[model samples]
Target: EIESIANHYGWQIIEQEIDKDHIHILIRYSPKWSILEIVRLLKQLTTYRMWQKHEVYLCRHFWKERTFWSDGYFSCSIGNVSKEIIQKYIQEQGR
Candidate 1:
C-alpha cells in the first residue's frame, strides 16, 4: 500500500519492511522531491489509509489526537555503503 502511494507520486521504493513499532523503507527519489516533501507524502498517505482501516484499534492504543506515526523521523542520505548493503541491512532488521 505504501509502495502504491509512493509510485503514484513518482517515488521509487527500493525495499521496505514493517516492524511492530516502525517501518523501514528505502526509496530513490528525484531531486525535484525534497526530503521533507517525500516524508510528508509518505506519512500523510499511509496514516490516512491506516486510520481509515483501523481507526478504533489505533485510537485505543494511541489515544492522542488520532496520530499513527511519530511527529519526528530519522533519515539520511545513502552514500559510502552500497544500496545493496543497505537493502540487506533493512531485510535483516527484526531478526
Candidate 2:
C-alpha cells in the first residue's frame, strides 16, 4: 500500500520497515510536498483503505475511534546523512 501510494505521487520509497508499534521509511519525494503533507496523505489514504478492507476488525478494536494512525509523526530532512545510511537504518528497523 505504501509503495502504491508513493508511486502514485511520483515519490520513491528507498526503504521501509514496519515494526510492531512504528514504521520507518526512507523516501525521496518531490520538493512540492512538505513532510507534513506527505505524512498526512499517507495516513489518511492508508487508513481509509485499511478500514474498507478490514472494517470488522477495526470497528471491534477501535469502537470509539475513527482514526488508525496517531496524530503525531516524525520526519527528518536528508541534509547531512547519506541516502544509503538512511536506507540502511530503515531496513534494519524491523530487525
Candidate 3:
C-alpha cells in the first residue's frame, strides 16, 4: 500500500520497515516535494487506507478518532552517505 502510494506520488522508496508501533522509510523524492509534504501525504493516505480496511481493529487498539500515525515525525537529509547504507539501516530498523 505504501509503495503504491509513493509510486503514485513519484517518490522512490529505497527501503522500508513497519514495526508494531512505527515505520521507517528511506525514499528519494523529486526536488519539487518538500520533506513535510512527503510525510504529510504518506501519513494521510496511509491513515485513510488503514482506517478503511481496519477500522474496528484500529479503534480497538488506538481508541482515537481518525488517528493512525502520531502527530510528529522524524526526517533527515540523506547526503554524506551512500544510498545503500541508508537503505540497509532502514531495512534493519525493526530487527
Number of the top candidate by lDDT?
A: 2
Candidate 1's C-alpha runs over 4 A off are none
Clashes of 3: 0
What order do candidates take by TM-score, descending?
A: 2, 3, 1
TM-score of each: 0.89, 0.94, 0.91
Q: Tens-digit lDDT track for model 2 on 1-95?
A: 99999999999988889999889988888899999889998999999999999999999999997789988888888899998988888888868
Q: Candidate 2 lDDT (Cα, whole model)?
A: 0.90
Across 1-90, the per-residue lDDT of candidate 1 in tens digits comes to: 788988898889998887888888899998998989888888998889999999988988888686777888888888798999999988
| lDDT ranking from best candidate downward | 2, 3, 1
lDDT of each: 0.87, 0.90, 0.89
The C-alpha stretches of model 2 lying farther than 4 A from their native spots are: none
